[model samples]
Target: MRHPRLCAFLAWLYGNEATTGRILQQNQIIFPAIFWPAPENAPLDPDAVLGTFQSAPATSLPEVFELPGQTYLRNLQKISPGLWNGRTYCMKAFDLTEGRPTLTCSSGHFFDALVSCDLLEFELLSAFGEVMPEEEAFPEFCERLTLRGTLHALGNPLHHACGRSAAIGISTLIIFPAEGVYHVLLRSCGSRLAYLDKFFHTVPSLMMQPMLADERMEYSVRHNVYREYLEEVFGAVEGEMPYTPAQYHDIYADPAIQYLQNREAAGSARLLLSGVAMDLLKLRPEICTLLLIDDPDWWLTHRQRLRPVTMVDSRCGSAANLLERSPATPLYAIKLSPELELPTGLLCPERFTPPGAAALCLGLNQVRKLLLYI
Candidate 1:
């Protein structure tokens, strides 16, 4: 009721009671209950995952829906003032039309559309008593909303017109190949702007964005993944203000990055593209990937750099500090040997964010046959 435009949109997508019940029965985190797995024989290497940037005229909400959407967003900001409306990449299209997976993205911002999507999810959950909708009542509720068939026009999960902000998130599963241990982060309740107390990838998942103004028109999934790895895994912090191209160059040049790059080049490390999917709750697109370091010596040499903590340090200043603070603490590692399975205790929805759980599940699905050789 609070976000009628969003309600209208959702009604178009899942207004049928049966559809709502089916998605609920499938998975609490992601829709279709499973990721749309990457095609077999699709290029798994990062460099091979092609992306292009298009400068298109920005899209706006219909005039009839604009006021209510803006009101909802303002209310959300009032509730969470720290929400930052930074520039982010919005996926305009994704497909394998070019003989390999390619993402067509454009410039956008956080506040333009994503926060509104969050608002919609908030409203839906609120209607269900601040929880996931009951299977029986949810569909009935959706069926009641006015549907304009907007979402149905958006095509399949792989292709669609961009929303106000179709922010594409990149989530990578990090594995220490020798030990067969893959890491995951437990977001501290005292920290994180969103998804607090949820589990994410060991290396914090990042929405693709240009760190410096000079790079605004460019987008690279590999580069985005590497930057998060440097910050979260190596605690490499970038200084504030007037960022330079050199700063980013140095970041990419870090020995740790170089080490991984060399291993990837040497066939000892792999960066596989798992696939992409939209979070069921938020409708945010996410790119799933798997990074495996298959060298015993690399882990042996750098394992000490991984600082694990049971709790966030009380004096932490920024969300970045929370991520850089403990690379592996407050985390879980699913073993790769004998096939990967999350620990029994972590099999519930509450333990992980939808995108994180989807990445792990989809990444494992992409890598399962390969694990047979391991």
Candidate 2:
């Protein structure tokens, strides 16, 4: 399907077809919360918790985290009861029953469990949940989250504050050659990093990033970006880097972050949005914002996560003016075949098939937009 991200998103929302009794069989556990300390400089609140928890260092990427195990996953698996009605498939439907996030969305009002987090569960699906199979569960699930519709979703994407998934991410652009004003060096990352995404064949991505190790750390709006950068890119023995203070850009809190509701793609979007690109530039802005588009190899590697698909191939330069374009227009798509098809049009598809993931599905395009400077 053309809009593969949308397909994965819908499938993730649908979750596994488990019975209600089966899911609840798992022992209930407190949904863990690592309370971040409020700013020391800020005035104290009488209503706030008395004990102080250190705030995590701030970073440009979504903070990688984990939730309480099987209970959370089982709860997600059983969320799709009313096919098209009620709270439906939203992970937000789960509420904080003590620490264990419990399902409680009968009234259909937006749940408060999500918004009440320190770092926030940006997307809400189990990163470890079972993969979505090839068959289409809902008849027109893919068709609904169109590329234009996705762009519309992103531009106005709200209400997706928090949920039950770990934030995932990858690099989109990286500069190269060191000659031109901006040499775009899209590196095919080392195969060792393949687990971050599909590495069936080495991919020369425009960006580079290491997967989050899922370590324990305090969540903060500042301090952590460089710490993560130094850890991921430089592999520094000490916490410091060789770059002079002058060479670096100002480290600051992220003014905003985009959030979409679908659990799988929402976490996956972190991989796309919060890559080494952000922290790298903070090292000294030599590496510009990573240029990224959701193409086919991307679809193959990250088929499970649902999102918007742009469907930009050789014919269409951008989705900006595709208002009248047919939603089902055949994508002049390609795969890593014996004979590779060369790019010739404004947009072209040059992708290779990976080991596993969905065969075909509709997806969404987050943007024709490019280059997010840190």
Candidate 3:
């Protein structure tokens, strides 16, 4: 007997019949409250968790307010001025300048603060950032800022963004009175297409499906199938999208319907990768060595602050062309098989084990070299 989940997934994939936005809406999305266990063999104090906030930036003494069931910190409280120390949560009357009631955080050392205590949570910290509609071009009312080119050019050259990094310009919050508890969602001003790849790169690490109950296999299978189906239909390099896939995903995943559910009850699931790559990780939070590319024939010639590395071709969609066209620097590629390895010894050599594949892969190198000549 075949697992019904696998059968359904195959059917959905073949037909390309997807889990619609309507179905995602039907499921409840919630992020479980994650907690870092106090180090083992040591006495952990709950009071200590509160004390950690001693240096928390507080304009005045803590003023506790009982609004709904949730507690809020009133006043301009600097829970942690530094991003690395811990997250500082505060509550303020809604302000037009602050943008919408959204979730905001940072990546890098700044995001490290969130782990220390969940007490430091944002509550009504103003809501005034941009609200991008799926069909609309970015609103003219605000300025568009993106790390698209510049981010990949950095010393670390992050491959993907997730976690606090997603909070760079947008906000994350639980949309009230809409659905289940702790419905975490993002509200960015413009198309966040560049950041999704970075965010989901961490998905394999999250062990997302196993965390769920056995009975929910039907829902789970359909969901993963939907994402993969979208990739096949929309991710292809050459095609005329009858409907823009990016736009569809955005609108379908809107807060009106979608929410992020936490896997663990106590909140220790480290699956939040919404903001890691494209400056969004500060909102949420890479692996791989940095490789530099040197293609002078590329666009935008600047001083050699960072030299670029060359890629030998083996057609698994090298990032070389993409990186060369962008502001991202220190570009690199990992060979999937011998067919994909560049001529560089610095990269993994095991890829060349299959001799025949290696020969076919060399053809890709020839094509790239020809492009340089032309």
Per-model clash counts, in order, read: 1, 43, 71
RMSD of 1: 6.9
TM-score for all predictions? Answer: 0.75, 0.25, 0.18
Residue 135's lDDT in candidate 1: 44
Which ten residues in a row are the worst by lDDT in model 3? 18-27
Roughly what TM-score does model 1 have, to 2 decimal places?
0.75
Instruction: Write candidate 3's Cα lDDT for 266-352 as tens digits.
Output: 232211111111111111211000001222211122212213422223442422233334333232222323232233332111111
Q: What is the lDDT of residue 270 in candidate 1?
A: 84
Better of 1 and 2 by lDDT: 1
Question: The CA-based lDDT of model 3 is what?
Answer: 0.21
lDDT of each: 0.56, 0.21, 0.21
Residue 208 C-alpha lDDT in model 2: 17
- Which order, best to worst by TM-score? 1, 2, 3
The candidate that wins on lDDT is 1
Q: Which candidate achieves the best TM-score against the true structure?
A: 1
Clashes of 2: 43
Distance from true position, residue 331, model 3, in Å?
1.9
Task: Give candidate 2's error at residue 342 in angstroms.
Answer: 12
Report the C-alpha lDDT of model 1 over 273-347, residue by residue, as the tens digit: 876656655556678788866687876776666445343222333334444555445443334334554443343
lDDT of 2 by residue, 291-343 (tens): 22323233343323312222323344332233224333211122211122112
